[model samples]
Target: MRLYTKDEIQHAVRLNTTVIDGIESAFTSLKTKKVAMPPIMRIDIPANNGEVDIKSAYIEGYDSFAVKLSSGFFNNPKLGLPSANGMMILISTTTGEPQAILADNGLLTDIRTAAAGAVATKHLSREDSRTVGIIGTGSQAKYQLEALTHVRPIDQVQVYGRSREKAEQYKSFIEKSLNMRVDIKNTPSEAVNNSDIIITTTPATEPVLKAEWLNEGQHITAMGSDAEHKQELDTNVLEKADLVVCDVKEQSLILGELRSCSNSKLINQVHELGEITSGLKPGRTGYNQITVCDLTGTGVQDTQIARYAYQQLNFKEDDYNE
Candidate 1:
């Protein structure tokens, strides 16, 4: 198998805004029946201090399977090790042959999650959206900002985090990298109230953005809540949404925003991002509508992105053994 290092994967895989575009195109194709993807299977392992997960998924027509193993970085501060690490494997479906292997671990995952947010914004956010708010100030936050800039002409950004230093750091980073003005806010509510579009990327177990803080016509993308117990928005906020969409209905219902509101019968309707891409569903019926897209991450995305990365790098199975 061809083995690709983290640097190799980073260089070979075009990420951020452009990759988000590609991921959108891929989902659109899937919606158009151009590609087929199987259900994603994920295994979560909770340790004494941290957690690890292994996920595998298959893409139809392409005849290949992609698997990813990832771990959290909670204990990394003391160990001097990066919090997250993992790898992806591409296997041929025709002969069950191992193809190319990428040591992406979490880089590709972050990019795909950001790309999902971009896809949702393109279809759900108002066309005149100018102000954006982001909750969280980690690596994923960077890609989320980059992807948002590609879809909309953002004029101002409000960032919120528990750590003021990190929030200020991210604000400066975005201002320099995207050349747009960014402001650090003291509270999550302030960030939500000040922006037209809100993106949450933290790993919060409770609601951070409340229903009362949101206004009509604002679009929210909640990306932090990927586990069953993790949540970022008030369950009532989902009841107030004009529309709710997810990367996959099944996955989101179990682990995303839907989990909190599922029992209350508050969700009016839930649709997949692919359906919106296929034009089978309407997006943003009016400028005053509140829209939310909950992304819990998926292996189908990882499979497509991994294949794309391998193809870009011209990776072949024989290279690793040579």
Candidate 2:
């Protein structure tokens, strides 16, 4: 088996149209091909403000599958370490042998997660979406914006973060890298009021974005809630949406914004994003409709992205000492 480091994986995989298409295809396969993806296994370490999630899946036509382990330690920055890091192990489907070890250090997860956000925005948001509201200043805040540019005609950005320094840093990076107009807002409501599309990338256990802050023709993508206690959107936000979508309905109900949603009828009406991608369900039926997509991350994304990364790199047996 081949072993690849984070640098090698980062060199091969990037958040671009091709990578976005690969993730979009994974959602399509999830709906049409009925890929077997198990429930996410989670381990929480409250003492260190950390959590580890294990995800895996088997796609029908793929030669290999991926079992990914990703961790998030919110206090890592204080220790001079990244908040998120992990790796992926690819196992052969036919012979049950290991194919490769992608020591991506969570780069693949970050890319695929943002790519999934892009896919959701492409299908669920308005065709004329140009202005975006960002509700966090973390790495995902940057990656999600980069991914959105591929699908929407995004030109303006409004940001709201708990830290002024980090928010300013985010604004500076965005203006320099994306060449877009970015303004830092004092509150989340201020950011939400001015955008056609809003993305929440925080890991707060309490609600960050309120339902009253949402408006007609606005699409919201809440991607920070991957654990049972984590939340980003107020429960009422889901109730007010004209349509609510998720990467996987089952996972969403357990680990996403839907977990806070207590309305039984609304839960039944929720649609999986894959169904919309596969053309089984309609998306954004009306120009004035309010839409929301809750992404909890998925293993199908890991499998497809891992495969894509492997295919893009050149492997040599001499590179690693056995």
Candidate 3:
């Protein structure tokens, strides 16, 4: 019966090793523990250029599970509002009753998504990777970069956005907050070229990155294609990658980059991130190999992050019981 606001949750959860490891552990549990995670339920509001996604998961041995509701209204920024917002509810397993309502206003989603990217990079990307290429200048663009610093020795950044003004703003934010050098690129190709780790965060319905732009020994994280119509990488990019991984195989086939790919053989070759994280399969077998991880977000991440945030707050149930 604990109700927490976004401000309270923000102070409790942050982008740190502890948070990153918690998310990584969720991935591990997905494979080893067989987490009961259902597919994401989405409702599209085409008239408003927005979509709402409902996700939830029940992990074994957990005292509580999380049900998260998050929305993305692409046109919100035009009205000076954020594009992402929502909340999560924690329900106890034993009692089958509500435990806590985490009204994080999508902050938990943002953090967990960014943490998932960091986990992908930590296990797949090269240890020596430093330079980063970011596509799309949004909240995620900044968050993705911030999360990368925790996993990689990132020092340089290149960014490409449709809006020059937003790109400039993002550059300033990164330079001031992370103290890293950032260069604005005229095209996605320009931004991706020569970068050790390339992250695509746009909500584009078309491919913003091409296969020809990719280089050997580089890692790419494609996280924007959480919908069936949204795609950031050319289908050829996935085909060309030496190793292609996904947050979930079935979900990726329906909602991620795999949904756009035509090659059935390539789709069959795709592996789940849990496989790599659980050590059942190898990650980055060669330093020169190209790796691509497609993340469409996952319910297990919500369950884990919500639980972690609740624990971090040091809540006492009796004090807030209704």
Candidate 4:
């Protein structure tokens, strides 16, 4: 049928538009009014000094199926290859036919994740938010910053990372690109101490930001914890949060920040991000409220994005038949 490279998808889909649309569609599906998104299945394959993960998901209402195959590409340093590589496949739901292929798994994933953050920010962050803090300095960190900037003024940014070099590099990149001053902080505490909005995108096994480091009137988006042993915030931080919303409650409880605090029943009253998106539940009650949105990542997002890619391709039976 039709094919779309990562560049084409980037040109065709705008971050804010795609994100807002995906959130609305996904939440509508989750409410059981329309849409059908099955759980995502992932397979990890060990490679030469690294591993690759293949993920597959399906959305019913959109009449499409998608499979994302990507790798960590950690061996790039020793093998002279990129650190990450992958692609996605979109299949027509009407006739179970192949529709389109996209070769930028990383880019697609980043946009969807950022969009999820935007949705959370729109619902949870205070209307007066201006300053933002980012606790990682990688590719995903850039998208996170860009997505937040699209939603808020973000006059000031505080960046923290394990590597001072990378942190400064990220700061320079964003400042030059966004034309906004980015303050490079030496420590995670420094980044979160006085920020109005915070985003954590690290792969730390232990807590990096302590509960005491946070202030009132702040919103936190924890986007790095996607596996069982990954965590970026102190369990006590979650306990102190005024409200904790997750992309999916079941997935978060198993692999997100909720896993770290499982020993205690402190996160019992958690709500899903979809519920907040649907307006079924209230977001931030006041400017002083402490809100946390734990995004463990979900297949529903992949499904919705895949559908968007298919529409962009303008797939038709004639193209396939030819």
Candidate 5:
């Protein structure tokens, strides 16, 4: 069997419009019965401020399927380690055997998650988008900006983080790599105001971005709340959104931004992203619409990204055999 290390996976994976389109296709596949993806299985190690999530999916008539094991330990960085690490396993349906093991250690997850944001923002945000406001300065924060720039004309970035030092570091990274001016805000509200697109990457149980701070014709992508007890945007903000979208309606109701809402009627009104991307429904029909995309990070994304990783390495299924 072929085994890919994290270094190789990192080298193979890239953020681009094609990656975003692939993720978008995965969603459509899920919507159209071309994929089979089960709900995310999570186990929490609360004593250590951590959780492990297991996800897998199968693309119909595809060469392989992928099972992913992902874990997040929030306190690891204090000890000079990354907070999240995991791997993926590719199994051949044609041969019904193991094909490749991508020891990516959550690298593909970060890429696919951010790439989903790029797709959502591209379809939901206004065409003239140029400013981006972000909360959190972790790896996800960097990926979010990098991915969004692929779809938008981002020229300015506003950042709000728990630490001024980390925010400054993020500021330097963005300014150098993205070649854009960054404003380090004292609060999320300050960072959110006057931005064309807003992203929250922090895993906060409480709301970080207030609903009242939002303006008309802005798009928000909340990627932090993938599990229970995690929320980044105010519930009222979701309630007030003219068009609230989610990657998966079932997953969103359990853990995404919709998990906080009290109104069942409003919750049922949420649109699945696949429905919009597949032309079954519309996305951002009006310029003044307040749009929000709740990203829970689906298993199909893992399957598709694993396939991309395999292709990037030029691997053939016949090359891996017992």
Candidate 6:
């Protein structure tokens, strides 16, 4: 089988609208019973401040599928290593043989996660949205804005971060790469106040966004709480949403923002992203609707992205030392 390094995968998988389109198709396949994706398997190692997640999915009628193992060691930065790293194993469904191994080190996850945001915003947000706000100043924060600009006509970016230096760094990066004016906000409320689309990308264990901060016609994509103990949006904010969507209903109800939103009486139904993508359910019914998409990440996204990268790269299966 071939092996693709992170650098090679990064070069092949350009973070652009094409990637977003592939992700959008994955979501549709998911809701239409064209995908078989299991619940995420997570192993938390509190002693090491780390967690490992295993995800896999098969698209019906496809010749291949992918299984990805990703880990996040929060303390790795002290050792001069990245906190997140992992690899993907692509397998041929027809013969049950390994096709390729992508040592993406979580780059695929980060890219697909952000592209998922753009897909959600494109279908759910008002067409006139030109401003974007994001919480956190990490790599996901940059990817989120980059994907947004590809799907929307974003002209301004407002960012919030705990560190002044990191916030400035994020601002400079956006201004240079996207050629858009980016404002560093002193508070999360300030960042969300005027933006048409707001994204919270932090791993905050408690609420960082409040219900009162959300305005009509605005869309919020909360992607922080991928574990049971993590959260980013207040429960009340989710309850008051005009429409609420989850990447996977089962995963979301168990560990995503939907866990806290389960008891809300205002929301009679919970929509899955795949369902919306497949046209089984409607998205963005009105210009004044308050839409929220809770993404916990899914295996179908991993498989789709893996397949895309494999198709773009030149295979080299010469690692056989036997």
Candidate 1, residue 105: the lDDT equals 67
Once model 3 is optimally superposed onto the true structure by TM-score, how far is the C-alpha of residue 246 displaced, in angstroms?
0.4
Worst 10 residues of 4 by lDDT: 33-42
Q: How do the residues 1-322 of candidate 5 rate in per-residue lDDT, one tens digit apiece?
A: 8799988777667888888899988888877776778878889999999989999999897889899999989899998998888999999989879878999988899999999999899889998999999999999999999999989999999999999999999999989998999999999999999999999999899999888999999999999998888999898898878999999988888888888888888888888888888888889999989899999988889998998888876643334542
At residue 297, what lDDT does model 1 achieve? 80
Off by over 4 Å in 5: 315-322
Cα lDDT tens digits, model 3, 1-322, are 8799988888777899998999999999999995889778889999999989999999999999999999989899999998888999999989989888999998998899999999999988999999999999988898899999999999999999999999999999999999999999999999999999999998889999899999999999999988877898899899889999999989888889999888988888888998999999998999899999999999999999999988876654334663
Candidate 2 deviation (Cα RMSD)? 2.6
lDDT of 4 by residue, 22-55 (tens): 7556754665555444444555555554555556
**C-alpha lDDT of all candidate models, in order:** 0.81, 0.92, 0.92, 0.79, 0.89, 0.89
Better of 4 and 5 by lDDT: 5
TM-score of 6: 0.95
lDDT of 5 at 69: 94
For candidate 6, list the clashing residue pairs, or say none: none
TM-score of 3: 0.95
Better of 3 and 6 by lDDT: 3
Model 6 C-alpha lDDT versus the unseen true structure: 0.89
Error of 3 at 296 (Å): 0.2
Distance from true position, residue 42, model 3, in Å? 2.4
Clashing pairs in 1: 73-83, 86-105
Question: What RMSD, rounded to one decimal, does every model reach?
Answer: 3.2, 2.6, 2.5, 3.2, 2.8, 3.1
Name every residue pair that clashes in candidate 3: none
In the range 209-295, model 6's lDDT, one tens digit per residue, is 998998999999998888888889999888778998888878888788987765745445878888888899999999999999999
Where model 2 places Cα greater than 4 Å from the true spot, the runs are 45-49, 315-322
How would you encode candidate 2's per-residue C-alpha lDDT over 225-285 as one tens digit per residue?
Answer: 9878899998899988999999998888888999988899999999898899989999899
